[model samples]
Target chain A: MQPVEHPKSLNEVTADKIRNAIVEGELALGAKLSEQRLADLLGVSRSPVRDALAALQAEGLVVISPKRGSFVFTPDSHVVDELCEHRVILETAAVRLGITRNPSELTRQLAASCDAMQSALDAGDPHGYTRADHQFHNAIIESADNRALAKSYVLMISPLKALRTHLFTIMTENTDRSLSEHHLVLNAVRDKDPDRAISLLSAHVGHLAEAFRANLSTSQDGKISPATLEA
Target chain B: MQPVEHPKSLNEVTADKIRNAIVEGELALGAKLSEQRLADLLGVSRSPVRDALAALQAEGLVVISPKRGSFVFTPDSHVVDELCEHRVILETAAVRLGITRNPSELTRQLAASCDAMQSALDAGDPHGYTRADHQFHNAIIESADNRALAKSYVLMISPLKALRTHLFTIMTENTDRSLSEHHLVLNAVRDKDPDRAISLLSAHVGHLAEAFRANLSTSQDGKISPATLEA
Candidate 1:
């Protein structure tokens, strides 16, 4: 968690730190989060910490037991599948909206992001590749020019990041194939073809399904500590 | 705002009240909220109120300015269009998933909810009928058995409710016709026919679009005081 200096707003710092922990998976899903422990960890009062926790709770990333404590939210397979489906819907819509609204500018950005992603792939740096991928999709949403769509994207960011964290660490030969599909998506988006972009995005979503079904139990997203539930 | 009688939990109450205000259009889109006045009006302390404000800030119902207080989220027409389109995606997918997974149960619930909606309409109550309409759709999402979908459904709840509050008041003539569409959708879901359900749901979404297009500026969610911005 990054610390802020110069009279930082307590809740802002607390929310950011907690968001970092969950996004980075330093605090694993379903791990108990004690207010006292967190207060000690962040060297802050519990008041702001509680407020921050409430905010995260609203985001569906944390669950609280009235008398007990808070824990990182642990989602089930059904949850993950539904989220993936939701992503497919939003992403495909973004692609269509992007193409329809601003073809040239979007195509230019897509080409640029593709270049960056390709460079990252060539350098064998998953971090760079992931950053590029994030920017690429974000650009698609921006091009869609729909604040609500972008907000939905923001809502999905945390869980998607969690998924990516687990996914990135488990490298397989599919990495190259995945990049190849990205190329196809880029080509489709560049051509300003909504149908093709949607199909590619569908295949992209289907790939996640394949990954989950092939190794349902092995999803690194599945890491819950019973101790947390009892905490 | 509902007050709690137990330990100090002003944040929860603050969040609920603000959300209601937004949904009711008492807080107009893009209008700034003063925290102190809101605290005074709602008769609570600032800490919990700020916490509530922050939560809504996250929900995209309110926008928080740096060093400034929160403002009502005023979405433009494009955003409205995009959100409705996304609703179509989720509802359609829900139909597809629900019909395949639990056709019998969903069929029964749809029949019940739709019938209830008709009863409410016969009773000449738009509000009751609207609720039945909501439940009929919600039942399908529940049948999908996806917490992610369920969560998205929850998230979508406020916006739809806001839209309904805006459009339903003037949509008396469309009420009976809309309920009939619900019946058609129920028939498809009962038959476990995803395609037919999707078609009906798509048309159902389209009807809302037509209604809104006819009266785009009439806001349903209530407005709040600009003074609510200060804390």
Candidate 2:
């Protein structure tokens, strides 16, 4: 028999709410998070909000300082580059394992996720598109059927989704290119071409770093200066 | 200048202490943990112990049930297989990145770690050897110079180490083979041969799974039965 699920504690629920807000870009990058404000907004007590922030900090989605207060993570070009490189390593492994162990499932899931992305893009729904995009990549990780790998992916994926949201909304990155890349990778998966799928995925992830670097170099306001990115 | 480090909170310290205890096999696998007893032993209040267990639970080093108390993670054959596969993926990526980005540093750190492991084996210190083994693998991850990847590796390393300790003490798995495998991988790394290093490391990790499976099949007590390995 399937085990019964326990109801999430208030702290867990609060953490999920704040995590979604950050990943969905409702909470702006590097925005200060006031415990009282969050509690008021979420209709919860300060204790749960405080616990949630602490939990989110552990997840790398929030930053807490003793003197300065908590803030959403802000990734600069260097952070973006490292994150992209890490994503490429993980997703490529996921693709290889998925194809080796469960090619049919991976292909089916990718096709479904790809269709969702197309629908979101056609509807001009950035939120929906981003969610679909998240699921599309997650399909590859999930198809590997390794909980350890999936847990690791989940830890890093939020910041990536948040960054994608930032790129989509602020940078206004071309969704059409992303959609096309997804289709190409999906087609390669369908063809059972691990090398082609991995190469395409690597390039696709690399483009985000390139875009971030290009944007950073051209910006005059020093919003995401290289100095801030250090460590 | 390096950023000043903040002192770890009571919860963080408690978590680290408990984590080490588990990883070192001082705390037996599947042994129930009492917050009160832990707090007393650690000379702290129960609150910190409670918080620490929650944190450890998040790290996959501890399991907390609504009815049953927290326990150190106990990996069965299937769990060992999945963990080994996950390690192979992450460490191979680390090997490639280390060879590409920081070969000299990787070689230096690995040689030192290998020497330490050899000394530990010569001295017949299982704990020291396991610690050195941990560092040897960590050197590869650190050389990759990717904090995101390193963080993911840290999350999964504890349970793996605990299993290694178990193998050493209970299963009495041959340490010589593990050491020779480490040296083989190190030699490949020193030669800057990413492909060879990764292949050797993959096989080395795969052996851990094979050992766990072999031991599980021979045990008549059902201590770590396949049923317990499920999720």
Candidate 3:
């Protein structure tokens, strides 16, 4: 794969930037992203930004809520948990093949992600931790070496960044626990132990399921700052 | 639960009809579908038909090929096999719950779909068989009782119908084999055997994968008749 990373046109770049913003929750979930304001922010025309919005909506990252206009598509706790379940299904299948096909490099890559995770945790910034958390799992998905699997994983989980950021805050409070899971997962992958890797991954995704439910149920109780934890 | 099937709007129904036409080869994969012509054929305005086209494009039944305009997305055999692998990931997960919950009515519903499958098989028309195949899997997915699962399943596979239909013509020659496997799958579900159901379902989907691959080789040998077999 050649670096294929560069977009030929500014529209593509703008679309991706907006898409990442939607994913990382620089844009609010269910918030209507004004096209004019976004164009101004991006220093581009409304046409490209609108095109970007259409692209994101097509990806289901944004919902064109009929006459009301386009807003970020927020998955409630139930959908989030379902996505986690979907993750387990696809990722488990991936691990069955991925760990066998490549173990040593997989371990190194995951360990690298762990380094970022630890740094983000120490920084005590929810946003940094959120991205690091994404990269941590991303290493495994990429290791799976199945383009379709990786695409589905990203498409299905892309909308959950908000909820994920919220959960990362809770996990950051017990910082060591988050970093510890990475070590266990990396080791499982390194040992070429599919079952252990899958179990660890499943538990990792499932724990987020339960924790998010708890947060959704009681986020307004005032002990935690919602802004600090916003997905 | 009461009958949960929501009545689709005219545009939605039109989209389904057009999608099937393209997928079943009534409209030929890669054949351009003119909005005005389709609107006249369906006795609807181009506006709704355009909306339908957009919807089908989202579903992937149609490709709005840039500049050249819209055409039915005709996937080759390689894409078919890959798409089947995706279905395996989804259907296997669905059957896990299908057997785990042991819902009695679910059996009867799938039984009805099985009967329809038999009728389609007896019809011996590839197009009819393809329609039946769609219904059969749609029923099985719904039996899984998870909306997110169903949505993900459609999102993953719907656009790839040209490939699936191309695969269907080859697999229909083994209709009895497929039906037998379906019976085993249904039996596993009825037995409240999650493990068995998942295994059988995985193998069933795997059969489709093989069939998809077979279509490619058949095409290379010029054994596939686009007209008669594309029925």
Candidate 4:
């Protein structure tokens, strides 16, 4: 049996709240983070907020500079490309491992997650769709039953998710295409085609980088600006 | 041009010192870590040591328990298996990326590192040999030029290195075999055969896990004991 998990400390809870804000696009990319403002907003002292920022910095979701203060992470084109390559390497390996180790469970989770994505798309809920999208990939990682891989995935995934949220919400990128890509991957997995599933998943992840690059090129400032993109 | 790197902070320095102790086997695996003891040993205060332990815990080098206190991580068979699998995935991907991106540079560094390992082995210097072994693999990861992949590789490599030190110093596992494996991988990379290089690397990393299991079964206790293994 699995050991009982310890409860999250206040610091962890604060970090999670800030992480969700960033990943869900409630906190804009590259926006300055004021500890005092955050502490006031969260109705806590500055200490927990400080700790939370430090924790988030390690996760690549927040950037803290001693002289310049803290801000949400901003991804350059190079960073986006590298992050996508890293994701493909990890997720493809996870897909192969998942299929080999636990095919039935992996297929079940993928199907369920795909159904959730379909419902979210039908209801036009971007947030729900993104969450289910994460679950679909997460199922593959979890099915691999390698804690180290899952931990590494969690560490690197936040920036990608934050970028996805930005693309979906502010830039209003086409969600239908992403949904269909997920379906293709799911079908391949259910049909026991690991190679096809992996290749389709790679292409699917590559599209996020493409979408980010397209937006970056079209933006007035040649950078991701919430104001310009939303307008 | 690359930006200047910031100097290490006190917390970071403290963490690095402690991390070296663990990774170098100066601090044995599963050894209890008292903040006061460590601070006294390092001639600092307890706060930084506490912070360092937290950081090391994040890297999977140290385990912090609320009730039991902090201890150096001890790997069971399952953890060893999972970690080996994780290493295979990351290193194999790094090998391919390195070969594709900069074959000449990768080949040059691998050859240099192999020479260093050979010299260390000839001199009967286990520590030097281990350091060279690390440099050989690090060359591959660095050659990939993906900061995300390199960061993940750094995080997971410490424990494996520590175990390797244990196998070498305590169990007296044959270094000749490991040296030969590295040579085979280097030759494959030099010959521009990524498939052959990756397969050789996969087998080479798998041997570490096999060595650990071999030692564990021969130990008097079911667990890894420094004294028991030393004898």
Best by lDDT: 4
- As for candidate 4, its clashing pairs are none
- Write down the C-alpha DockQ for each prediction: 0.46, 0.63, 0.41, 0.72
Task: List, residue by residue over A171-207, the lDDT tens digit for candidate 3.
Answer: 5344577678778988888888899988988887777
Q: Candidate 4 regions off by >4 Å? A: A1-6, A220-231, B1-6, B220-231
Which pairs clash in model 2? none
What's the TM-score, to 2 decimals, of chain B in model 3?
0.77
Q: Which ranges of candidate 3 are over 4 A from the true structure?
A: A1-11, A34-51, A122-126, A166-173, A220-231, B1-18, B31-71, B74-77, B122-129, B167-172, B221-231
* Tens digit of per-residue lDDT, candidate 1, span A132-219: 8778778887887876667776776667666555544555427677777878988997777799999998898778656754544665
Worst 10 residues of 1 chain B by lDDT: B222-231
C-alpha lDDT score of every prediction, in listed order: 0.74, 0.81, 0.69, 0.84
Q: In model 2 chain A, which range of ten residues has the least summed lDDT?
A: A222-231
Q: Per-residue alpha-carbon lDDT of model 1 for B1-231, expressed as tens digits?
A: 778656645667778888887776566567777778678778887776787777777665777876777777765555667677767877887888888888899999999998899889788877788779889988988888876666666775576566556445565338767888999998887777899889999999888866765555655443433324222
The DockQ value obtained for model 1 is 0.46
Model 2: native contacts recovered, as a fraction: 0.59
Q: How far does residue A62 in candidate 2 sit from its true spot (Å)?
A: 0.6
lDDT of 4 by residue, B1-231 (tens): 779878887778889888877766677778888888788877789878887888798889899887678998876778878888999999999999998999999999999999999999889887788889899999999989999999889888888887776555653777889999999999999988999999999999898789877775565222334231110
Q: Which order, best to worst by TM-score? A: 4, 2, 3, 1
Model 2 lDDT at residue A28: 71
| Fnat for candidate 1 (0 to 1) | 0.66
